[model samples]
Target: MDSDWRMWSRRDLLAEGMGRRGIQHAVEDGWLVRARRDRYLASTAPAELIRAVRVGGRLTCLALLRLLDVFVLTGGGLHVHMPPNASRMRSPSDRATPLAGRGSREVVLHWVPLLRSLGADDPRVHLVDALAHAVCCQPARHAVATLDNALHRGLVGEPEIAEVFAALPSKYRIVRALLDRRAESGTESLMRLMVRAAGATYDLQVVIDGVGRVDLLVDGWLVIECDSEEFHSSWHQQLKDRRRDLALAQRGYVTWRVTAAQIMYQPEEVAAGLRGLLAARRGGR
Candidate 1:
């Protein structure tokens, strides 16, 4: 499949001199799927590319980060970049499907010009540009999560990010500076960002004897572990976590576990609890 043509509009085919009937023929022959009103996807197109086109925008921000295998807090909905002058723009509410109820595929639009540098092989915004857009458009912690994963994957480096930061608005520059590649998941990155923003000192992925690597070590003795469903869904995994916590306790580290729910739905409460713990630790010391 030509990567660029894997997901495209009817106009793209018409521009190539293939009339409307040609597109219809391809659909009938099972070569294409009508992804949305005007968007079409090759039968073999990647899900992300299909989603990008279906949303009437290029895949970008967290969407591109997902394709790069970077850690992004999932379920924030589809991220797409639509050119300001693009035709047939509609609000997300108007685009919802009744059969799907609220719809799992809610689209988040980033209004911007299409980057000219995007290669023919990609239906998404170029990585650097997407990262820049992500940093500017998302909350600082969420943006940092994407940056951390990009760095971890070796998809981007500090220098490229620095260059991107140079062009970003002043508010997002601080998030770029705070990006730490050591974060293994979006949850950990976000929690760490919140802790720091709340004026506490912490270290990420800190190694302790007999405890493997803990997620975040704050104020010297408190260990914070960000637990996703992947870590805690099984009884066996819960037993292992308990054992790890016991080991850390024996070694003079206090282990605290945070869940995806607390991170997503109760961030302020999470911050408050972290602050209380840090304050208590300081008082004890």
Candidate 2:
């Protein structure tokens, strides 16, 4: 099997008993490619990594988080991390020419300093550094969800979170209080934020009499199920959603099944619907 894509610098290759000529031969054979001036990466590495290097920086921000299997609020383009003093960067798709002022839509360049040193030869940014960058890159609510996702996945510990905060400005310190490790998914985390933003109090991962465990329970009568965006979503949803809703309904609990899209894009409408429902419940009494 191929190695774990550990960076192979020129010196590393030489130390591994491979001659300069052998290295060139491997490159010619398409077995390896020079990722940077003196660094090498296996051709079998993920295309995104290769492209990030081609774009003149390390894969970072949401791109790195996604590669680490951590959750991100949204997706688009290649997020490349350039040095704070980096200049004359190349395009994400075309490295031959220098990128214009700022960057292109296809490549979002984060010209920020790293909190932790991601080695010079590494093609990806460090996790804590990426999370910090993500917090700056995304909106406040989405940033909290991203952090919650990192915690939910157990990707970082206290030290790592501390490092991430050290990298961010003071304004983001408030977000530290919003994290919820109990959040099973980014969608669920975002849903919880929506509840808080709507001035509603809720219990997380609460078990009702017959509804099993729920994402969020508001006012002891509402169950909000955050249907995260996942592959086979419809199929997985059909497995238990209606059954859970029916069971909750029978027990006098109202199940509000919130789709990922609605929570992510149309949050105001969801909050309004929530308020309307809650007010109606109060009025009925």
Candidate 3:
């Protein structure tokens, strides 16, 4: 009858005198349902976490990031963080379908030995640890985008970021170097990373004479505007964008816009476009 009874292991319930028959009655009465092998949850409990625990792991990486309501480029997996060398077949007989999708859904196992240090009572990874693991696992720009959002939401602070960097190995710290709280979305973060990687100079969130504040100003002339779908959806917003482009163009600033899809899904195309624009500028064309 307790609200905390949302989830209970069979052994724990038996120890509490629920017994096999009582448990069966609870299941039959629609008060409790089996989540996985020995685990049961109230009918109303959130199904988000069931698959991760069923696989003998805690939610981490992209899955945890999404659950925290942070912006992510593209991730639709059941990412589970397990102890190193842990068997995939913890309870092979009882496999719960991962919650994300049918064919595209798969349990991504991240083997981290450090998980053993956490208490056995909880399977949820701490936010700092999860972020650190995410940085190590994700692509450089995606990882920085996660960090930026975390900082933006005050879900993490400078001290927390410092701790994450300290815990990471030297090589993995490159991801941290890309972290910037100024980035408002994954699209902007990816654009900056791509520009920097291509050896081009850029200033982020730069305010020019015409455009109030563009996402990036590249090589003192090219204005890069990064748009996420949600912001650019309305006609009013499109009109404002066109006006901003016209205003910037009058000031001799060429506006080059990149959408979230282009930044995330078409990196080569984005790079090619940037290359052409830069070449044109250099050639005075």
Candidate 4:
């Protein structure tokens, strides 16, 4: 029952008064499943964490951050952290077999050690380590977004942020200048980068006299709101958003709505679109 409520070591079960026979009986009774040698999982264990254990690595970096509800710009596969010399990897899908080849792309693996290990039964990388690994996993802007997301959610403060940078090489320190706690969402962090790359200036989380607070204001006229499908999909929410847009428009502010999907799945397209509109604005047409 202890140890993050899911993964457990054999010693953990033994400490909980489960002897050898008792452990076997629990497995047979479907109360527990053997995750690996000396490792076990409760029936209620999360499939993702189980996958990390089965793959012979800890869930980490983007994979773990996304699981913790932090901002991750890209998504594709399960991310894992293992020692540089670890072996006997199994397929994440079926725990029964070993991986067929050198490595599977489906399981993104990080052999580099960013931080000290956590408890044996803790199937996740430490949050600070995960953040450092994420810095290595993503491009510059994306990495900054992830850091901002962590800060905005109060998951880590400036000291922890300093620890993350300390784990990285010196060149990465440049990204520290871009980290801003005010970014309300990962999307806003990304949108801010896109706006800058478009050669436009913006004020983040700015408020106008007539309109309420906005995600970002570009050149004092354009307001960009990073919308997510889950929150902005409702009829009522859409009406509210439309009204907000109109209100800004009436006050000589142009509002651009960017969806989460469009930003993550279509970055180049979004950047191109932003450039065109920003150019039009600069031309005063």
- Identify the leading candidate in terms of lDDT: 4
TM-score winner, 2 or 3: 2
lDDT scores in order = 0.75, 0.80, 0.75, 0.85
lDDT of 2 at 181: 84
Decreasing TM-score order of the candidates: 4, 2, 3, 1
What would the per-residue lDDT of candidate 3 be over residues 1-285, giving only the tens digit for each residue? 344324578887898899899999998998876666676767764455555666666667777788778877656776777766555333312554433321134666666655324544354577888888788767777888889989877888999999888878898778777788887776788888888877889988988875699999998988999887789979999999999999998998889888888888999999889988988878888
Task: Give RMSD (Å) of candidate 2 vs. truth.
Answer: 2.7
Residue 45 shift from truth in candidate 1, angstroms: 2.6
Candidate 4 weakest lDDT stretch, 10 residues: 1-10
Off by over 4 Å in 1: 1-24, 34-40, 46-48, 51-57, 66-69, 73-116
Model 2 regions more than 4 Å off: 1-4, 84-88, 229-239
RMSD of 4: 2.2
Worst 10 residues of 1 by lDDT: 94-103
lDDT of 4 by residue, 197-220 (tens): 777888888877777899999887
Which candidate tops TM-score? 4
Tell me the alpha-carbon RMSD of every candidate: 5.0, 2.7, 4.6, 2.2
List the lowest-lDDT window of 10 residues for candidate 3.
96-105
